[model samples]
Target: MDWIQGFLVFLSGICALLFLFRKFFFKSKLANKKGCDHNCDCH
Candidate 1:
């Protein structure tokens, strides 16, 4: 029983860390629009 509880807690912590990391990094990458024009000065 104790080991199961500990495993659950560890899994929750890993999930929370992944969530925060994606919120900070992956979210921004998804929000930005890719440059479509090859000759655009914005590149």
Candidate 2:
């Protein structure tokens, strides 16, 4: 049970790190588009 809990904690930490990186360090191309509300097949 301890090992299982540790594994879950590790996974949660990884997920949180990835989320933070994506939120702060990475930017989606579509998000930078102007006057585009839906998928415009721009790329």
Candidate 3:
């Protein structure tokens, strides 16, 4: 039971780190790009 709780804590930490990295790095990159790949006339 103790080991199971520890494993869950470790997984949560990893997920938090990944979420922060994506928020800071990937979101900015997408905003700076000057193109739209989605449907509709964005140009």
Candidate 4:
């Protein structure tokens, strides 16, 4: 249906925005840090 296609497109747009935000806006925990333990995401 047309609504299904529109919903898919909206979800894809949201995913794209999230990807962009994660790529450029958010900082990675692996950078410029010291004494990282195995429990952290830096591993």
Candidate 5:
């Protein structure tokens, strides 16, 4: 029972960290100009 509780706490910490990372670092739009397409010259 103690081990299970510890595992759950660790999992919760990892989930919280992932959520914060995504919230701060995830971008919703592309920064590059000219857009994305097979014919686009931008790399």
Candidate 6:
């Protein structure tokens, strides 16, 4: 039904948003010991 389709779309959108947030806002497992925002010679 139309409701089912809408629900699926909403769920997919939520998942996509969470994935994006985790990627940009969270540190990656592959990063070195220094991390991203840590003080270093990054500049």
Clashes per candidate, residues 3 or more apart or on different chains = 0, 0, 0, 0, 0, 0
TM, every model: 0.61, 0.57, 0.61, 0.58, 0.60, 0.60
lDDT of 2: 0.71
Give the per-residue lDDT of model 6 (tens digit) for 1-43: 9999999999999999999988754444424455646553334
Residue 16's lDDT within candidate 2 is 100
Q: Please report the TM-score between candidate 4 and the true structure.
A: 0.58
Better-scoring candidate (lDDT), 4 or 5: 4
On a 0 to 1 TM-score scale, where does candidate 2 land against the true structure?
Answer: 0.57
TM-score of 1: 0.61
Error of 6 at 43 (Å): 9.4
Error of 3 at 4 (Å): 0.5
* Candidate 6 colliding pairs: none
- Worst 10-residue lDDT window for candidate 1 reads 34-43
Candidate with more favorable, higher TM-score: 4 or 6? 6
State the C-alpha lDDT per candidate: 0.72, 0.71, 0.74, 0.70, 0.68, 0.71
RMSD of 2: 5.8
RMSD of each: 7.2, 5.8, 5.3, 4.7, 6.8, 5.1
Comparing 2 with 3 on lDDT, the higher-scoring candidate is 3
Q: Give the number of the best model, judged by lDDT.
A: 3
Which stretches of candidate 1 lie above 4 Å from their native place?
27-43
lDDT of model 5 at position 4: 100
Q: After superposition, how far is residue 37 of candidate 6 from its true place, in Å?
A: 10
Whole-structure CA lDDT of model 4: 0.70
> lDDT of model 5 at residue 5?
100
